[model samples]
Target: MLRRLAPVVLSLLVMVLGVTALAARPQRSAPPHTADFVVVAGVAGLRWEDVDPRTTPTLWRMAERGSIGSLSVRSAHRPTCPVDGWLTLGAGSFAAWNGNRPAGGCPQQAVTVERPDGTGAKLPDQESVVHYNQEQLPWGAVPGSLAESVRCSVAVGPGAAVAAARPFGRVDRYAPALPEDPTQLLGSCVLSIVDLGTVAGTTRAQREAAARTADAQLARVLAARPPHSLVLVAGISDTDRSARLHVAVADGPGWERGWLTSPTTGRDGYLQLVDLAPTALAALGRPMPERLFVGRPAVAVDGRPDLADAIAKPLDAEREAANQRAVAGWFYTLLAAVLMLLAVAVLPLLRRARRHAGPHGPEPVPRRVVAVVELLLIAAALAVPAALLADAVPWWRAERPGLTFAGVTALLVAAGTAAVRFAPGYGSTLGPLGAVAALTALVVGADVVTGARLQLNGVVGYSAQAGGRYAGLGTVGLGVFLAAALLSAGWLAQQVRKGWRPAVMVAVTGLAVVIVGSPYLGADPIGAIALTAGLSVAAVISAGGWLTVSRLAWAVMAALGVTIGLAVLDLRRPVGERGSLGRFLAAFGDGTGGLTLHRFSTSNFDTLVSSPLTVLALAGALLVWFALLQPWGGLMRLFGIYPAMRAAMAGTAVAAVIGGVLGGVALDVAGAAAALVVPMAALAALRVLDHSTDRTVPTSGRPRGVGSGVAGEDGSGSDGGGTGGVGPLGDGGPGGAGGATGGRDAGRVQPGTATSDGPVG
Candidate 1:
């Protein structure tokens, strides 16, 4: 009775626990000191080495007395741009301009503009166009702008003002005259933005002159500020080269005299641009809402002079070198895919040759040789994780990437060989495959839990230098790893003892969902959606008898339901803490959701048009199709010959492809999906090859008059030994399909026992 009730009780317990965990609010750290006002000087594309103490004494002094670091300006949708950077800093979220202009055209000079109520106001000549664009363009808002939380805010330049005015609900536009003493304005405005257009100067001499002027202006403001004022000087972007890394410095209240470190990038001298607003709010003693901001606070770290030097290099050189390496990596990946396809095409001929060679054949490759081959495959399977670990090795730091990659591959292969030789279940068909899948899941999951340190450097994982993602698994890694682990683990559970098998399957599924879906762990909205939907369909198919159109529909509906439920929970969090689902919903509410969709669509279209990634994706899809229909009759037939397991594999493949396509389209990188689907497809093909050579049955069709080795759901005659004849199930016995039991075994086959004659139709 207790056993029967266990599933129900466990299900309820898990659901309750999940809800409670999600509902808990995040805690904010107390600021080291309080500040009355915060000033942000926006210097577009300002580099540390460009500023000399003699020419820009103010900036140099601030760096020595405050905190400084490299500011990563990459955004979710595009490379860093000045307009986007200022907007993101002010809004505390990722944002972009629609590049629309007002119908009447922009103002060329200073002019008096009237509010909708007819009140006249003077606007800066350069800022008039920006003001017009702000009112005309459709904008996406996840949270109220930073200005909304402060008592009063001032924007000194057009770029700064455009972002500052976003949260204002009134129809008035005004530009207050700059005070003679810049510090005098601090008493009235709690926040201020001063844009110096530092990168606008074309020549070194011109740039130096502009820097001196900006420095003097900054000195005046600092001299006038109150005792508790906080100042943040940042280079929002390099207009000429958007991808160049820039600088950020923090001074005054609560900040220590050292370099900056952040959890987002897991680098001591690096902080993302999105972190600025949150750090300012924390310094000013404001409460931060959950999930609304993608960045964490930048903490002060003990000064590391070498770290600063490493980050202070010319942005152009660093970007050029990184781009070169990335291109080479992509080319190598494409070559590998082509080779995998070639191997698949040749597998059939090899299998046929083995079959024609009689009972002994060419005595199987020595165990040692086979083990070496298996280890190599295992290393390939773990390519992403291995690359991540390789980044920290001292030899990897020597800039000989090729040598480091080879060494890491060899090490992983050796480790895998040792495990296969000693690990339990290694002799079983699913053992080694399951072990690889499980290890991949564990490594990736553990990295995510611990701030995604290794993945931050992994070739296939998030790239900190590129700033595409700072944490969490990439779409491709998540989809591929999750699918492989689930299928392998589920199959392995079935091969073990009966009493704990069902529980094992349940546990595996549950753990997978928790790891991938939990916001604090994976923090990936799209991933959570895809995994929830795909896993649900796979689980159902694994438990049910077969896949049909109606069953498929139900499975899809169940998946959709789970996805929506998770999205709704994300929406319940504060606007600042909301994930993609919540952000999209918020944008949709204000009719700006179309822009977000357009960004995703354009990104996907660009990737497809520009790269060979699509070819890899198509190859993967074709491989899965071939495995299911022609070569293996599906992976299900090869494993335990259980119809339910076959249904599960088929369903999972469909789900993975669907998820991969959706992820590729949504994330705008087809390579991510290709990376995921290609590996699993190759594994499936390999599984088919392994089964074909080992099984005794004819390749083309079902057996003629023999019993299957597996038992029915009822488990009757499960332990029966061999019967008669030469059959695939076992050594043959008597009475054809029913074995020695005659007609009594018509609907059921004894487990691990087979008749000598062909199976009965």
Candidate 2:
């Protein structure tokens, strides 16, 4: 009874314990002392690669002496232009222009500054931009929020005016351009923002010239800087339509040479454009407006590599992210194609195998073609993890990145599949399923537990450039991890004694949940909730393949408890220490979460249509229903004979629903299940189809013929290698078509075992 109820009771208990422990953790230290003045030097399309020692000496010097990181310039739209970045920085929130792009891609920055009072300047159209972000978009950005937060501010160029102007378009002080000798301009206010112009160009030489000019301007500003001031330099936006990582650097008290990070993006060496506003406010010792600002103060952790080596890091990351962005869509299409081709080939190939066999009516298909199909299925099942592993290689730098990436992934899949399929005891249904499931679970689990480094910009993983996530499991990772973990639980249940099945399932799934939601690990609270629900289904089904109302109520309770616990846990963390989920909840509590649902709905809908995982999901469903669930597929028979497998399938269904709705990547869950479960189901179906072809039933296909070996659902047979050729993976005794019976049996067929002429099992 305790084993049967383990998942229901233990999962809830462990989550509570984890939360309690976190609640007791020590509070973090306070922030650095405030600066007298905060100077923001904004540049559009600045990249770390553009900072050359000789040409851009000032910028390079700043990179070496100050804390530097790659800036994620994501706003409400992809490829955030100069105006959008400026507006977002001023608002301290994600902002965008809803208008269509200009012919060259991004809209040109043409700010018309009016001399309102003869001493200050005003923006003519700044109010419209403010209204769009606050009223029309989900971000609720109010242009000039940074300037509004301070008593007075200064602006040097057109872009800077967008950032420093008041809601009604007034700037305390504004200049058309920087003067050669203007210490008074910067010292006019505690907050000053100056635009260094655009550094991105279509040609290398053009970019170099732009960098030189920006560096010269920066040098002049630094020379005239007031004492006890904090300086911030950033590539604030994309120059064109395509998004990429930009440069970020901070130099001030307690911000000496180190890596830059923010609570918004927990990972080191990464900060968002929104963070710039919060950083400016923190530098000037202003109180952050929780309702308006969605960013946290930036922190610079000590330590960095040599200047040259540190510079190459962001450059390399950008290359990989760009490569993945280009090819990720096609990779999903290829996976869908693989599933479709297998669906098309299965029936025809099986029919051909039947025809090749002698007219011994109802005999098993005897062609090696089945082995080829099974092998291909095995490779497809492990494709996600294989693709993630492939990221370790510089396939993106190859002359043909897409093709090179595909080939490398294929090689990895072949290698992993071969190792699993050819390992000892492969003949047993448990061996192949267990090995494949465990491998997938282990790879994804280890990645999430560690830093998920391989998942960054991976073909099947998320990129920092997207700005939706940073240090934890992305939707794709969630899908893969949940599917593999559930299946792995099922496999472990099979190895234990029947009475201990549900107990083991609970243990495995509980550990997986901890890793997925621990804040220090996967940092996916929703994933933890979803997986707990799914595994409870597996646990109940394994105990007895029934989902009564009582069991469902318990499962729902466990999931809900986890959800509330995660939310509470996040709320308790300090403002600058909370994850994305906590920040959302905080924003929601402050009334800004009103449009969050609208935003999520729009994004989820867009992903549903644009992602190729949708095609893969549709194809997988067609194949599963038309081929596996149908009577002829033999999978239905296997489920009845193998309760552990039934438990795995049922649990996966529950997970898909919950994870998809909450994680906003529904098709990813389906695709992951299709990749891992479909192939294993196909293998099980093959065993059932070839059940009678082994030595036990023989070519005579008669019920009373000489009994050879009948491979039970567990693949244990009587004696002798069965005549069924399931490749080198199995022998008819104890493990499948060539399955072997219990060791207790010598050469005799076990009692109560079914024959070709009798009912199955």
Best by lDDT: 2
C-alpha lDDT of all candidate models, in order: 0.53, 0.75
Residue 385 CA displacement from its true place in model 1, Å:
2.8
Q: Write the per-residue lDDT of candidate 2 for residues 1-761, one digit (tens) a residue.
A: 87667654765466566555433422435556569999999999998888879989998887788899999998876778888888888888888755677654786747688986866899878888778887888777777788989999999998898889988899999888899876888998999999999887789999999989999999999988878999999999988878889999998887888999886776889999999999888878888875788887888887789778888888889999999987887887788788778778776543332111233444444457677787887888888889888887899889999999999999999999999988876766556777888888888888877898888888888888888787877777777787788778877676655567776777777788777776667877677778878887887767444578987887677666666777787788777777556776887787767787777677668878877777766777777788777656666655644566678778887886677766776566666666777777777666554543322333355333233354344544312234332221222122233332222222334334455423222
lDDT per residue as tens, model 1, 273-371: 878877777777776644355566677777546433534543332443354356336633744574365446434432332221234444443446444
Locate the minimum summed-lDDT window of 10 residues in model 2.
725-734
TM-score of each: 0.72, 0.89
> Which 10 consecutive residues of model 1 have the lowest summed lDDT?
736-745
Model 2 clashes, total count:
20
Model 1 lDDT on a 0 to 1 scale: 0.53
Candidate 1 residue-wise lDDT at 513: 59
Task: Flag regions of model 2 displaced more than 4 Å.
Answer: 1-30, 348-363, 692-712, 715-761
